[model samples]
Target: MRVTTQNGRVLLQNDVVNAAPVISTSELRGLGMESVAYIRAVEVEGEAGFAIHAADGTPMAVTEDRETAINAILQHEMMPVPLH
Candidate 1:
């Protein structure tokens, strides 16, 4: 039997499948507040902008520049992932 990981799930050539990995609340808490964040382009109040949000969905900042938004998250020591 051959096992491999794909998209956080385990797959076996013998026709077995494992569920996606899960993160516990305690484990997330241990990572400290706002350890991760997402940067997304958005239009708000009739203006186009980029927004940064914390892992818990809290709004961090909004700016007219995408790079500025991402850099702001990095300045806070948080991992920033761009959202399409």
Candidate 2:
């Protein structure tokens, strides 16, 4: 198991190919689900849109609509989490 931190969050990287590794909640704020992402509503240049970001808060992409943003995240094998 490899552990790294980015943006003050702990990230556990799985090194084993086919072995199932158990992780703790304190280990990852978001789990080992590789492509976890979240969507947020934003106004860019006076245009309403949705913005997709990685678990570490890195900007991924922006879409004009909510459905399209969700689809784009899913297409990339990323889980879209709701932000409050």
Candidate 3:
């Protein structure tokens, strides 16, 4: 999934559809979901925002803050994958 930064923290892409943000940048450090190179839309309701699964479905993002969460299309690339 696309990744960006707010205050320098590595954040996951909001979403590419509807120009919405995947995760709220308000009181948080990066995304709670695992890391992915892409994003996807899921079928759900409020407080159950959309779902973004990683290539391997390992790193997924989910927000219960609002009814619907939409990520933007323009996004920044993530830093070179860090070596664990």
Candidate 4:
């Protein structure tokens, strides 16, 4: 995803998907706070795991398996965004 800002609004373009998702400042402020979650790799006491967090960076859950983490987010009716 390619992120850029225009007039204080954030623009996200996915090259592979060939789509642009626009988020205004107001919308950006609420991103991940609802309806969306993020997945990222983390180190848990020297063990690797996938950490799930709300869009606003609030910790939600952690799982040893990536697929499990994704499914958990989906089961919550949230869109899962994986961060590398």
lDDT of each: 0.75, 0.81, 0.40, 0.82
Best by lDDT: 4
* Ordered list by lDDT, greatest first: 4, 2, 1, 3
lDDT tens readout by residue for model 4, 1-84 = 678778976677676665655655457666545888898889999999999998768899999989999999999999987665
lDDT per residue as tens, model 1, 1-84: 678776675555553466454454555667864588897778999999988887767787898998898788888888886555
TM-score, structure 4 vs. true: 0.60
Q: Whole-model lDDT, candidate 4?
A: 0.82
Model 4 alpha-carbon miss at residue 1, Å: 25
User: Which is the better candidate, 3 or 4, if ranked by lDDT?
Assistant: 4
Off by over 4 Å in 3: 1-35, 46-49, 63-84
Clashing residue pair totals per candidate (backbone < 3 A):
0, 0, 12, 1
**Residue 79 C-alpha lDDT in model 3:** 18
Question: For model 4, what is the error of residue 11's alpha carbon versus the real structure, in angstroms, after optimal superposition?
Answer: 18
Candidate 3's residue-wise lDDT over 1-84, tens digit each?
677777766667654565644344333235422232344444465343545334334444554332222242113222112113
For 1-84, candidate 2 gives per-residue lDDT tens digits of: 678886665667786777555454445566644578899999999999999987767788989999999999999988898887
